[model samples]
Target: MTAESALTPTPAANAAGLPLALDAVGGDHGAVPNVDGAVQAARAGVRVMLVGDRVKLHAELSKYPGAAGLPLEVVDAPDVIGMDEHASDVRGRKDASINVAARLVKDGQAAALISMGHSGATMAASLLILGRLPGIDRPAILTHIPAKTGTVALLDAGANADVKATYLAQWARLASTYLKVVEARENPTVGLLSIGEEDHKGNAVTLEAHALLRQQAGINFYGNVEGGDLFKGTTDIVVTDGFTGNIVLKLAEGEARVLFGWIREALGSSARSKLGGLLVRGGLRTVAEKMDPGTYGASILLGVRGLSYIGHGSADARAVKNALLRAARAHQSRLIERLSTELSGPS
Candidate 1:
């Protein structure tokens, strides 16, 4: 595929006149959130192809008023890979909902795909169907982590549990391209996740990776950053092995939830505080918007051939809709093409 083919054509329609393909049967709530999400995106002027069972999809689509009037299409792919199913074991099930949507994107029948299914399955399907980018061996899971200033790119979120120092180096290069093409950030700074600010704090791998990043040339390496630096906006991109990255991702998510819960409890402790809470509701909402991970949508699987996004398995309608929008944006911005080209060239 050519560089331009990775992006979704935005004028009138795509070359195949297709929209995003959503695995409408993937979420935990069955087809409700998926259908609602598709309706929401369509109402927002994005064309969508909800991929799932024919009869069930139409039934869900009919629940929303004016849904039929929007640019919505349905393609049936009835099989579903359960959340507990191992990705490798289920790879041959080409008829699975996730696999079907991936096939659509791979065959040029759709611009991009969004799935709130077994995340590993989604990643596996993307690799199995769409294949990897020319120079990338393993695809990294990249997501927009809400930061104190703006949002920082967190990569290798949960794709490969173990990666080489060379992989981390390549991740920095890909992240730089991602920041430029999709995020519009020029010359984004990168930081390696380590125990301390010192260059020699991490293990042998990180120590080696730090040296590699410093000499990587194209990307802006800002040396080592501690865990506290993630939300501090210390750097534009944070790179780490999938094991560490996944732990950090979950820790941040849980921390945010607990923090909000505590605040809510403290606010309702008394009438005086309740009034105070009411007064600060607007301010709190602004804070919530900044902290909510749903605002960032699905983790973009970089190094994959076509654009594939994986949403939370328990995603609600809002989260699903945001994932769809994120996928569309990545496609329109040609994130995959840029990463492929960047990695294909010299460091």
Candidate 2:
């Protein structure tokens, strides 16, 4: 099929305002948080299709009064893919919750798929079933990092560990399109993550990618940005291979938790500190909320033919709710279609 035609959603999939398909049994604590999150999203006016063992899912739904009244439907998926299972296991378990959820999107029964399950399995199912967007060599995970100014878009968060310079350049274009269409950013700037801010600072891969990005049209290519620049909001988008990007993402998450814990402990150590803490409690809470990974929830699997979001395995109800809402918003915004046009257009 032509690249454009391949990227186009089936008519059923394109039907206005379809519900988001959620893997109800895929997470550290399966079913409970997923059901609660689905209920929360339904209350917020987003339709949800919960895919899991129907009996277990219904039992969980019973915990919330009037949950039956919400815009929620359960799709029976008898199998489950454990967090420890290899992603390739999806091939053997076609009835797995993640696979079933992905099928909903492929069949046009849902607009998107959201899973707080096995990350590898989620990515595998998305790529195998929905296929890649035209001109996309490999799909990358787009993650949002809270920055001093605003959120910074980081791609290849954990998709392809070893990548070529060309892949990095393509990700820059993808990240740019995503920020503009989904984030409403105008002419978003791109940054190549490297050892230093200089053009010749990085290793062979980054050095080559920097050259490609400088000449690439459409995106506002910012020069090299160091690791520290991520929090400084040095650029609207940061491009890196999955290995480095994944490390950056995990390190940021760990540091944020440790720092916040230290702050709370110090604030509660004495009456004098407690008094000061009380005074700044509201402000601290506002900052804490902004830093919460749950605030943005899942990472977007960009360059796929359809929308698929992979949430943290330990995601709580709040994270799940946010993920569902975000996926719905992206689909409503026609993100995939817009990305296809941008990728297929003049370079």
Candidate 3:
């Protein structure tokens, strides 16, 4: 479909449009959170299709106070791909919710798909079922990190561990399209992940990929940026291979948790510290809430032909609601089609 057609807003008469197919059987905590989140999304005027065992979903939905009247659908899948199931096994099993949800997207029965399942299995399902956008090698699980200035798109969060220069450039283009859609920033600045801003820096892949990204006329390449610059919001988009991107993501999560733990302990240790914390409790809580990654829903799987999101397994209703809104906005913005066109253009 054309970019304009892909993003045309749903008619006012049908505000919610098609229901989003959610792989309810996929997360580590089984189906409870998934079911609860789906109910929450539906209450917000977003219809949801819960894909899992029909009997189980019905049982859970019935337990919810007002679930019976909600705009929800339950798609039956006899078997669920266990959290520990291999990607191949999940793909081979037709009864898995991941495959079924993907099929819903492919069949035009759903606007998008959301899952807090195995990251590997989600990518595999998107690729094998929805297929990749033309000229896009692998689908990158790109996450939107909230920064002080705004939000930054970090790609290849955990998709392709090993990548080529071409794939890195594709990520830039994909992220650029996303920025245009979400931020409405014309010619959004793009930066490569590296140790320093110097021209000759980083390992073999980054150095070579830096040159390639610079050469790509489509992306507004902003040279090398350090890992510390991620939250600094130095650029609109940060491009890196999946290996480095995954490492940075994990390190950031760990550090954020550690810092919060330290702050909590320090404040509670002594009478003076306790009094000081009480004085600044409101400000500290506000800062911590804003800095929390959970404020931003799951990451977007960019470059795929269909809409799919991978959220954290620990995501609560608030995070899931954000993710659903993001998916809807992505459809409304036509970000995927724009990325496809940009990446398919001359490199």
TM-scores of all predicted structures: 0.93, 0.94, 0.92
Name the runs in model 1 displaced over 4 angstroms.
Answer: 1-17
RMSD of 1: 4.2
Give the alpha carbon lDDT tens digit for every residue of 127-196 in model 2.
Answer: 9999998878999999989899778999889999999999888889888998888767899999999999
lDDT of each: 0.83, 0.89, 0.80
Give a tens-digit lDDT track for model 1, residues 1-347.
Answer: 31122222353533234599999998678789988877877766678898888899999988888877888989998788888888875567878888889999999888888988888889889988899877677889997787776778988898989899988988888889988987678899999999999988999889999999999968999999999899998999999999999999999889988999999999999999999999999999988776776666577888788888888888888777777766776777777777776776875
lDDT at residue 204 of model 3 (Cα atoms) = 89
Better of 1 and 2 by lDDT: 2
Please give the lDDT score at residue 338 for candidate 3.
Answer: 73
Which candidate comes out best when scored by lDDT? 2
lDDT of 3 by residue, 279-300 (tens): 9999988777665665666788
Native-referenced Cα lDDT, model 1? 0.83
